[model samples]
Each structure stands twice: as C-alpha cells, then as structure tokens.
Target: MNETEQRRATQLLQLARNGDAESLETLLASYIGYLKVLSHSQLDPRVRGRLSASDLVQESLLEAHRDFTKFAGTTTAEFTGWLRKILVNNAARAVETHLLAAKRDYRREYSLDLLRQAADESHARLNSMTAVHRRGPASEAEHQEDLTVLSNAIEKLSTEYREVIVLRHVEGLTFADIAIRMNRSAGASRMLWMRAIEKLREAMSNENHE
Candidate 1:
C-alpha cells in the first residue's frame, strides 16, 4: 500500500477498535468488492438465485461489526483472514438455510469445510492472475495489491463478461459447464470467455494508467 493508504488503514483500524462504527464501515467498504467476488465465486450455483453475493457480504460484515470486540488480530493480513473466515462461514450457513428450507434437492450440500476449500481455491486462482516472480513479504504485499486491482477491474466489467470470466477462472468451470450454467451453447461460452479476457486486459490496463 501507499503511505496514504497505510495511514488511513491504521487510523481506521484504531478507530474501529475503539467502537467507532463509521470507521468500521469505512474499513469494510475497502474490502466489499473483494468479498463480493469471493462470495460469488464460491456460492453454490444451485442456490445463487436465493443468495446474493452482496447480501452475503453484508451479512458477514454485520456479524463482524457485532463481534468486533472479539477480534484479536492487529495487522492487515490478520484482519483479511478473519473477515474471510466469517464470509466463508456465512456463505456455508446461507447455502444450508436457503437450500434445505426451500426443499431443493441438489447434487451436494455445502459444508463449512467445502465452502472454505472453494474460497481457498478461488483465492489461489485470483493470486495466479497476478503472478509475481519474487518470494518475500514485499512480494506478498505487491501480490495482494495486484489482486485488489484485478478485483476492481473485474467489478467494472459487464455482467456477462464478469460472469464468464469468474466461472472460467475462479470456479475452474469447463466451457460446457459454464455454457450450461449460463444457458448458452458451449461455442458461445468459449466466445464469451475470449471476449471477457480481452475486456479484463483492457480494464487492467486502464486501471494501471489511472
């Protein structure tokens, strides 16, 4: 992060720790986009209509705010990890609540462990998109920043483009699977995937320039 970002993060962290709700909200806002992408990528496809990614992230953030006093972590990494755990747990609960209550018979149920595994796999794929050669704390920080940039870029994409890219990369779905999920032919899904990659590259370039 830049010096300004670091200073803002520090100030927000301190204020949030002191029971400042607005500060906590501001801190969480910085990550809302990232969390949305994670939630979308990991959400059970069968239950997506009933569970929105934004809603899930909001619910998780609310829980985090309510239990702020219980958090012991002081660093940015620690904070991210803590929030990720909450998001994963909330997602798992959401799937169970919506799927079972709705009485929909799916091929599988989303256990907490499975949710976490999916999140980890998606995060790994996200990290792979911004691969760096070095290995150290500095490299890790750069990687995280790159991910944030990429996430923002993805968020800027059109829904169709974003959906295709996320399914193809983050969820590791094949063209046939994505086609079925998107209600498109496999050839059309491949075409959309290509377009999405082109758009993603353009978005990243624009972000870099800005």
Candidate 2:
C-alpha cells in the first residue's frame, strides 16, 4: 500500500482495536477481494465443486469477527497475517470435509496436515508473486495492495483464462494436474496458461496506467 493508504489502514486498525464495530466492518470489508483470491487460489479444484472460495472467506471473516477482540495487530500487514492463518485453517477443514464426504478413505487420502501445509505454501507463493515487484519497508503491505490490483485484473479474464492462471500460478499446479482438472490435454493446458498469463499481463498493464 502507499503511504497514505497505510496510514488509513493504521487508523482503521486502531479503531478496530478499540472495539469500533463500524471500523471493524469497514476494515474487514475492504479485504473481501483479497481473501477471495487467497481462498480461491488455495482451494483444491478436486473439492471445489462441493466448496467455494466465497464460503471459505465468509467463514474466515466470521471467525475473525468473533476473535477481533483478541487481535493485537497494529498495522495492515499484521492484521492480514492473522487473517491468512484463519483462512488456511478454514481451507484445510474444507479439504478434509469435502474429501471425506466424497467417500474417500482417510488412509488413502491426503492428510489434513498436508492440506494445511499446501494451503500455507500456496498462500505464501501467491503473495510472493506480488512481493517480487518491490523490496523495502512494508513490502508485505505493498504486496497485498498489489494483489488487490492483480486480483482485479484476474477477475476480468475469461473463465477459461482465469482458471488456468489460478491453477498454474496461484495454486502452483503443474500443467499436467491442471489438464486433468480442466479435462484437457497437457499441451492444451500449457497453451491455455500461456494465453492466460499474456492476458493477465495486459490487464495489469492497463490497471497500472489507470
């Protein structure tokens, strides 16, 4: 975030810390898109038909709201970090819940710990995509703000393109896995991802200019 935006977030943080419900609502509401991106990026597509990023985000926000009084964050980065932990836990639960409902044997299926680990890794990697854009103080805050911008650009893409980008970049899925999920040949998936990245780049460029 810019200096002005960071200051604004800090103000909101203070109000939230003081139990201002409206400020808390406004502060959390601003992160809707960000939480969506994180949840969507980490949610395994195998279980996504039964779960949704929006639902996960809602659950995370609800949990955050309930625990807001316990939060000690004094800045946006710290607040976001706390929220992300909840998001990952929720995501891990979603994976376990859906897989079990699908009648998968627990012994054969991936462990819940693995699910959480993957979610954590994916979250970090996705943020790294934005983090690489700059380096210095409050870089993480800048990373998040850039993610908001990047998320906006990603949303404008065609569903096909967006899906490819999410699987390949956000979720760190290999082209082969993406192909299996998308029901396309590996070569086709690669081509789609290429196109998706190109479109995303153009969208980001447009956003930068605007």
lDDT of 1 by residue, 14-90 (tens): 78888888878777776776788888876776667888888888899888888888989886667777888899988
Q: Give the per-residue lDDT digits (tens) of candidate 2, residues 40-93.
A: 766777768978888888999999999998887677878887888888888767
Count of clashes, each model: 0, 1
Q: After superposition, how far is residue 102 of candidate 1 from its true place, in Å?
A: 5.1
lDDT for model 2 comes to 0.75
Q: Please list the C-alpha lDDT of all candidates, in the order they appear.
A: 0.78, 0.75
Tell me which residue pairs clash in candidate 2. 1-142
Best-performing candidate as measured by lDDT: 1
How big is the RMSD of model 2? 3.5
RMSD of 1: 3.5
